[model samples]
Target: MCSFKLRPSKLSRYFCENLKIMQFKNTAEFAKKLDAQDKLASYKDEFIFPVINEKEVIYFTGNSLGLQPKRSQKYVNEIMNDWGGLAVEGHFKAEKPWWDYHERLAAPLAKVVGAKPEEVTVMNTLTVNLHLLMVSFYRPSAKRFKIICEEKAFPSDQYMLASQVRFHGFNPEEAIVEVKKRDGENHWHLEDILKTIEEVGDELALVLIGGVNYYNGQVFDIRTITEAGQKQGAFVGWDLAHAAGNIKLQLHNWGVDFAAWCSYKYMNSGPGNASGIFVNEKYLDRKDIPRFEGWWGTKKETRFLMEPEFEPMPNAEAWQISNAPVLSMAPYLASLSLFDEVNMDLLIEKSKLLTAYLEFVLHEIDVELGETTIFEIITPKDRGCQLSVFLHGQGKALFDYLMKNGVITDWREPNVIRLAPTPFYNSFEEMYRFGQILKQGILEN
Candidate 1:
C-alpha cells in the first residue's frame, strides 16, 4: 500500500515556473491532488496548529516540540479538579490518583521501547534521568573509567556525561571517549565502533549514545552497539529523546542496560513533560547496583510507615527519587492514550511511508533544480520520521526565510535543517506544502 509517486509537488510547480501568472492555480491544484491520494490525510485533525497572519502555518518542527493533543486540556482539568476536591487526600482519594499515575504511563512506555512493564518507569527529564542512571550504573574505577559517546551528541547529553566524569573524580578530557567519524567520512562506521570496543575491552566503563542522532538522524544499530559495549564490560545506555516514539526500539532484547527519553518530541506530550527510564529487568534483583534512594523508592505498602530505612522497590520503580509532577504527567497520559489506541506497529507503517514520501519529494525537487542544487540529506536510509538536510552553506539564511514564511522547521547550528513528519498528525498535503515552501525558501535565499 506504500506508494512513491511524485506527481508535480506543490512547491515545485509554484515557484520554478516560467509562466508566473499560472503558478498559483497550478500549486493549489497540485496540493489538493496530493492530499486526495494521501494515506495519512485523516491524521491532520489530531493536532493543534498555529495560525499566522490569518493562515495556518505548515508545522514541520516535531523534532523540537510536538503539538499538543486536544485531549490534554481535559486530562489536565481532571487532575486539577482532583486537586481542588481532594487536596491532601487526592493522592489516594481521586480517580486516576497521584500514587498510581506514574505506573499508568509505564505499560505504554514499555511498549514503545519494547521493554517489560517492570523495566520502564516514567521519571525525570531526559538529561536529569541520564544523570540519575549514571549514579547507579557508571561504576568507574582506576582501570575502567571511560565512557564512550558520539562526537556530536546533543549538547545537554555531552554536558551531562562530562560533568558525570568530573563528579567521579576523573578529568573529562581523559575519561570521556568521543567516537567520531573517520577523516573524510560523512557518517560513523559501525565496524570502527566495534573495533574500538574490542581494543578498549578492558578500559571502557560505559557506552552512551543518542538512540537516533538529533543532528544527523542516524538510527544507530542499538542491539549491535549494546552487545559490543557489554562484550567490553561496559554498561550501555541510550538517550532516546528523538527515538522513543519515532522508531520501534527493542531496549530489553537489545540488552541495553539503561536508557532515558523525553516525551515532548514525536511522543506528542507537551513541553517539559515527565520522561521515561529503562532499567533491564536483570537488575531488578541485583542490589549491588548503587542507587540514590528516597521515600518513593521505598516499598509502597510500607512507604507510609515513615521508616528511615529505605527498602527499595523491586523493579525500575526503585529509581524514583521523588513523587511525580501530576500536571506534567497529565499531558503524557493524554498523548500515551492515543498511542495505546493506535499501536506502534501501525504508526510505524505510516511513518515509513510519510518520511519516504518526503524524501522522494525532496529528491525530485533537487532533480528539477538542475546541477547547482546544494541540499543534501544527511539522515541514513533506515532512520524514522526525521530527515536532516544540509544546505551546503546557506543553512541559516534559508532557515530564516522558511521561518519568515511561517514554515516551522528547526536548524542546527552552522548547517543542517531537521524536519520530522510525525506519523500521528502530519499529512501528505502538509508535506506537499512544506516541500513547496522549502523550494521557494532555497530559491529566494
Candidate 2:
C-alpha cells in the first residue's frame, strides 16, 4: 500500500512528470505516484546520483557514502574564494570567520543529535574521537575493567577497544566482552544484552556499543541499554557512525557518558569530512576527569595569552585537540544547513514509511520465488532506512548483477547486502524499480 505521484520532482534529475494520482501496484506507474506524494521527493534533485552507461542508476548505499549535495560545491567555492582574495587574513576577515568556523556548526549539529549546543562539537574521525573519549571515561580498576560491545562492531572499533584494554595492561580476551546474537539468529535481542550487563555487575567498567550494527542493520535501544549499564556502575558510550542522522537521538537526555560519529554516511558530509562527539554536561565541568589537552581546547579568553598552564573549555569543545580543517568542514557546514531546515523528526517519518514499503515489496518477491527467494532481510522493525539483506550462498554474483543493471547496493563479506532508502534524496519509485530489477536478476540467476 505505498502510493505516490511523479510530478516534476522540483529538486533533481529524475523523470516522469504528469503522472500523479495513481494506485499502488507492482507497475512502474504505481512507483511514479508514490514519488509524487513525497514532500521530500523534490529534494532528490539537489543531489548528484551516479549515471551508468548514460542512464541514471538507482543509488542505495547511503549507509556507506551519501550522495553529494548540489550546494556542497557552492560552499567549498565560497571558502576558496575567501582564501584566494584574503589570504591569511581570511582567518579573521572572512564573512563567516574561519577562526571560529567549527563553532558555527555546533548549534546545527546539536539539533541533529538532540543535545545542548555546548555538549556537542565537531572533531576528529570516529575511532580517533573514540580513543580520545576513552582516555577520560575508560579508567579501569582491578575490580572493574570489562567493556561490553556487540560481536561484529566495525573493525576499527574492535581494534581500538582491544588496544585500549591492552594499553591498560589487561588481557583483551578477559577485558573485552563481545555480546553476540544467538545461533541461527539475524538480529540481537535487547534482553540478552541487558542480561549480560547485569551478570557483569560492578565488574563492568564501561559499555561501548554501536548504536546501529553496521553489517546487520540492527538499531539498539540506546536509552534502555545506557540505563541498564549505568545501573551496574558502568560508563556507557555509543559508536554512532551508522545511527547519527539515520535515526532520531537524544544523547544528552539519555545520560550517555560519551559518543562519537562520522558525518559522511547519514549526515552526507563528504567522505572523511569530520566527526562529531557528545559528552554529558556533568563531565564538562569536572577538572578531575583526565583528558588530553591542546591549544584549541583552552578557554578562548586565555587561548592567545601563551600561558604555560592548560585551562580546558567548559563543554565538549574541551575534547578538541586542534583547530578546525575549514576546507574539509565546508561540505559539512553545507549539509548541516539542510538538516537545520528539514529537521530529524520530519526526515525520520519519511524514512520509516519508505523502508517499510521496501520491506513489503521484497516480501512480495519472496512469495513469487517460493523457497528460492532472492534474500532474507536481517534488519528488524526498529531499524532506520537501512535493510541488510542476507543472501543465500556466495551472493557476490547477485551483487554484481544488481550493480551491472543500474542498481547500487552495498555488498558485505560472506553474503550480505546493505540498502538504504534515504529520505533526503531517495524515492519510493526507485525502490519499486529496484525490486523489478532484483526480480529480473533472480530470474536470470
Among all candidates shown, the one with the greatest TM-score: 2
lDDT of each: 0.82, 0.86
What's the true lDDT of residue 15 in model 2? 18
RMSD (CA, Å), candidate 1 to true, equals 5.5
Report the Cα RMSD per candidate.
5.5, 5.5
Clash totals for all models, in order? Answer: 1, 8
Flag regions of model 1 displaced more than 4 Å.
1-40, 393-395
Clashing pairs in 2: 4-33, 4-34, 5-33, 5-34, 5-36, 5-37, 11-45, 12-45
After the best TM-score superposition of candidate 1, give how far the Cα of residue 187 lies from its true spot, in angstroms: 1.7
lDDT of 1 by residue, 1-445 (tens): 2333343444322211121212222244554765575555676776788887677777788888999888889999998999998997899988998987898998988888899999988877988888889998899999999889988789999999999999989999988888888896557878887887787788999999998888888888899999999988899999999998898899888889999999999888888878899999988856677988788888899998999888888889999989978889999988998888777877787676667667767866676676765678887675888888888747588888888887888988678888898888876667767778878887787
